[model samples]
Target: MTMSQQANDTSRNPGWTSTALSQLSSVVRGASPRPAGDPKYFNGDFIPWLTVAALTNIPESKTIVFETAGKLTEAGAQFSRTLTPGTVIIANSGATLGVAKILGIRCCANDGIAALLDLCSDVDARYIVYQINSQTDRLRTVVATGNGQPNLNTGLIGAIEIDLPCKDEQSAIADALTDADALIDSLEQLLAKKRQIKQGAMQELLTGKRRLPGFDGAWSFEELRNLVQTPVTDGPHTTPVFVDSGVPFLSVNNLVGNRIDLTDLRFITREDDQIFAKKCKPQRGDVLLGKAASVGKVAIVEEDFDFNIWSPIALIRAGSSVVSKFLYYQLQSRSVLTQIAVLTNSSSQGNIGMGDIEKLQITVPCVDEQSAIAQVLSDMDADIAAVDDRLTKARAMKQAMAQVLLTGRVRLV
Candidate 1:
């Protein structure tokens, strides 16, 4: 099978897709960073190691951690039957489920993740790794045992099967998909550099360290009410009618620390946004600030998607007082977040209100300064956006390659 033929889902490969099944077989949990253990375990040169912590905010990749002290010695390696290099490791439980990484270096992980070993035999490991990653979520939804904890056991993993094809085809698929991954990683690095450049611009312009060519003026505190047009509104004091599918209901949880992940936005309906837009309909540049669950997390509603409100989320309008982009970054700055946290009502889940946000003071430069500052930051933001777009395309290319190659639709060497 060639790449083109394998890509067609309706073709013969549709049935089994030439795959295999397996599991971590043995589970190794993470170490307690503290507590009496041999100092040698942690005191050595850093090595690649993984924990669920590694999965928290990164995209799919190998070598998540840079520094590693907790590692298996030669003796430990012998006893543990660790998977060889190039094996895929994945998170099995908790907030992150089914996230996997191809191990780039010889390393081990704790309980937060399980290492799927023994890929060369019944299953071509790389191909099997792809199959496992693509299926785990669906596998997870269907498997049932206890609500106390959700997990995928070895038996569950082995039973989960894929369309079987010739091993040569499987190898071909893995190889093609790998090329796509390589392209994506390269683009991501470029994007990272663009963002770093922007951040440097922000630190200089906003701090007065480097002033752009033009007029200069002293910064002063401007009262928000007088300078601002849109005031912040607390989301529905009452609970929203949440359906699995509805208009995306915005909340602190929905707003990640620095940006809005449109992919994971919770839903409400046209009716809900209508019922709530008086307080929650956010515009393109409107800043979506978190008041309840977290004090100062801020994201902008850039998409045209209709969304409504939930507790702890406050919608702010642009009254022409503060630059939306400027305010967004300011709120995200370390100082503002720390300030908000300190002033917020502490609870199992943190909550703050519109009034509290309004009361917080901020320094304002003139409109010209605001525009100039925002321009520099906006350039940086644009650079970041461009880089992120490349990363997205890279991942998508890989996903497509996987669908084709793994299914025997494509053949490599």
Candidate 2:
């Protein structure tokens, strides 16, 4: 079958919308420079240098400080950085391992960073970086050569054979992909604003500064235990329990940015799901509180899907004293995670016990007010989710286009 057939679209990337895998050029592991704090090493000259940390920062612009992570005193370029504009820098190994970035400015990179350059005219630096992003999973699969620290050497990088296109077509494909990315970025920014707006709304409403319309009520401070049913539960942790197909199971990874991704889900069997249903099973309208590692992500299950949790999650169902939506908004508020982290029994990663959340005191407004506030926040969420859904479809479209165009199985005008 042609590559276009494989990607399921023919007209998207006409000139074989191109992407480069990777090539191991000159790999440098990085040097223990005499510390940035050392006066001898840090002469305080602004020489642009790249590191794995620099690559991790997506929007890093200014060179606040630089001498590069590794020192090459007069060996070849000395303090003079060697990166040219539009070069692809790959983090072969480091704390921020495997991240790739496009350099706007030329700078000397640490030995821990691998530089891929000198591509043919058909390839663009930024385009190559984008392609490598798609190839990172494959790169990771083949990382087996480092002494103890596996790395992407020149050999491994060069062998990453991706389909190619003419230079202009490559640029066009990159531009289109970048357009989708920029839309996603804008949606993300809007999501951030929504969070900030909701935070303000919460403080105002909960503090009685801004009362919702028709809110006539008094609140009695009560134990959280009195307001919520059994608030704790564990997940199915036994190995091989993961069925090839069954019910969607939620672990700590299921929670991201205070939201549960219903897509890309796993399934549990009818029998096992029934067993865990009482303890960790998630019902519609119930909130899932992260109890370990990535703590304080609160998501209310939207539908009745067969889902069980691990020990790191606390399933909370607020009783009549509160609305689940209100409580979920409260948990998702800005300071809630910080507060929860402090209360958790986190030896390595933070973890909040069901008891930790139960004893907490929150100034909850009357039910009607809580419902109104929940509605406002939920509206903002719906707006964001709409944008997210659009972006997801757009990206899927692009993926289909890539498959078809890059394989020369389809043509585009």
Best by lDDT: 2
Could you tell me the TM-score of candidate 2?
A: 0.71
* Residue 346 lDDT (model 1): 51
Per-prediction TM-score to the true structure, in the order listed? 0.69, 0.71
**Candidate 1 per-residue lDDT over residues 1-413, each given as its tens digit:** 32244335435643444322443233333333333244544333344445566566565543233434355444333323344466666666766666666666566565556665555454455666677666656655765236777775545555555555666666666666666766776787787777667667656666566767785777766444454466777667777666788677777777773677656766666777787777656667777777765667788866675566576777766567577777666666545566678767454556666666776556667777777787777777776777787688778777777766655556464
Clashes of each: 28, 16
Question: Which one wins on TM-score?
Answer: 2
Compose the digit string of candidate 2's lDDT tens values, residues 377-397: 788778767877765776677
> Which portions of model 2 miss their true places by more than 4 Å?
1-37, 42-45, 59-80, 95-100, 116-127, 130-134, 143-146, 154-165, 214-220, 229-284, 292-295, 304-312, 334-339, 346-354, 411-413
Off by over 4 Å in 1: 1-58, 63-69, 72-79, 86-104, 107-124, 143-148, 151-164, 223-226, 229-288, 299-325, 345-349, 410-413
lDDT of 2: 0.63
